[model samples]
Target: MSKPVLIAGPTASGKSALALALAQKTGGVVINTDSMQVYRDLHIITARPTPDEEAVVPHRLYGHVDAAVNFSAGAWVTDAAKVLADARAQGRLPIFAGGSGLYFKALTRGLSAVPPIAAEVREDVRARLERDGVEALHAELAVRDPASADRLKPRDRTRIARALEVVEATGRSLTDWHREGLPPLLPPGEFAALFIAPERDALYARIDARFDAMLAGGALDEVASLASRNLDPLLPAMKAHGVPALIRHLKGEITREAAAETGRADTRHYAKRQFTWFRHQLPEFEWVMPGDARGWVASVIPGREANPESRDSGSGPSDHPGMTWS
Candidate 1:
């Protein structure tokens, strides 16, 4: 059997198409590694694979989560472990793909074994964050868990609140929890990983074009539906690249054009960050330019022929009907 493949890159980098191609060749399962793509309510906005594409090959974890759930990397890791095991048991290669660097990191480098904070505790902390302001929480955390506070930026509302909640709910600092991290699901040498490096000008153009395409593809309607549900604004689904901007557009807070531009800009920025993150945090992944990615894959996997119909050389989005890159 071929080693499991981990295809990760910035959004719209065609990682999904590459994974699908590999799965077709190796009879593998395509596993989701993107955080936003997990939400059931964020199909168009998150650029999740379409029903038709998913029907072409077995996919795990895409759109399996509710928008309201505060899903985390740890939760994803847990889900992925099961999916990986099932794929192996069925004698299928495991193809992981997405732009979530943290998910990839957790999959390959282990994650802090912080137990789930109770819903009540999480809500209380979030409420306090809104009411007391992040600075106040930072001060409180400094007193209670100085190590965590010192490590976190004062303005980082999410991590600060999380650290405070962990301490409040478990009487342990996040630092202490980090010491007892869960081992990686795919440890070193067990997987062949690659980061698709796209040219900046071309990538930005694709990001811009894809944003408009998503708008034309009913992304606004999708966001409208999600916004009507009145989910917490801090929820991951609510904060998806296009969701917040489109929500503001729905509220008459911004024009649709402005919202689209904002979403495109945000996505572009996120793509840049993904490049930096994988370079620094997951250096184990071989960085290959998009045009060279297929060759890299064939070279790594050995003896697999390139799919004749898979026309995406990673210059942009895949034209393959069975693939949609997030």
Candidate 2:
């Protein structure tokens, strides 16, 4: 079986384009590792591949879950395991592509096996957080589970609530459960991973241009439709990069120009965060500039040329002597 190719990069870094090109060349199936792209309701806003793009190659796990469900990393792992198995059985290369660092980490490094938090307990903790604020929750956690509280910041509402819920429901600290984690789906040296590291200015320009294109392509309409559903504000889909600002625009709280600006800023910030996260969290992934990415992949995967005309054109990795691979 061919070693799976995992392409990770920030938003607007051409991850999808590279995945599609590789998939076309290697008879591979592209798998979604992005957290937002899983929601069926978010197409334009999430920058999910259009139907035409999907038709180019076999794609799995995109827009498969309802936005109402609180899809977790664990759930994504479970779904991805099945898809990976199928790809291996069919003798097709699995190309995992996306910007979600946590999802990638969960796949490569095992995730903590924290049991499900009861709905009532979860709701109660969230309600308390809403009423008493995150500081109060942190104080409570400090009294109940000092170790977790020490590890978590006071302003971290999500982690604070989760730690509190775990302690309340199971009488065990979150750290205790975290000590035992599920085994990694793809262990070290079993797969080839690459992180695209484009020049920051160029990437930021691309992100801004992409957001404008998305707005022109009816991102506002998509957000309006999703907002009409009145799902919980805390839901991941509701807080997607552009969704919140667009929803504010829909509510007349912000002008369209302001909303667009906010969306672009948020996306740029997210892309920056993705770069830092992948660098620090998954250091094993080799970083390559945009122009060199295709050539790098071609080198790692035997019999796969970076471009069909490269040999004739004499413009391959051999020509660019500065290409870095570690």
Top lDDT model:
1
- Point out where model 1 deviates above 4 Å: 304-326
Tens-digit per-residue lDDT, 71-151, candidate 2:
889899999999999999877889999999999999999899988777888888888999999999999999999998999
Worst 10 residues of 1 by lDDT: 308-317
| Candidate 2, residue 24: lDDT | 68
lDDT of each: 0.87, 0.86
What is the clash count for each candidate, in the order shown?
0, 0
Could you tell me the lDDT of residue 121 within candidate 1? Answer: 92
As for candidate 1, its clashing pairs are none
Q: How many backbone collisions does model 1 have?
A: 0
- Model 1, position 160, has a per-residue lDDT of 90
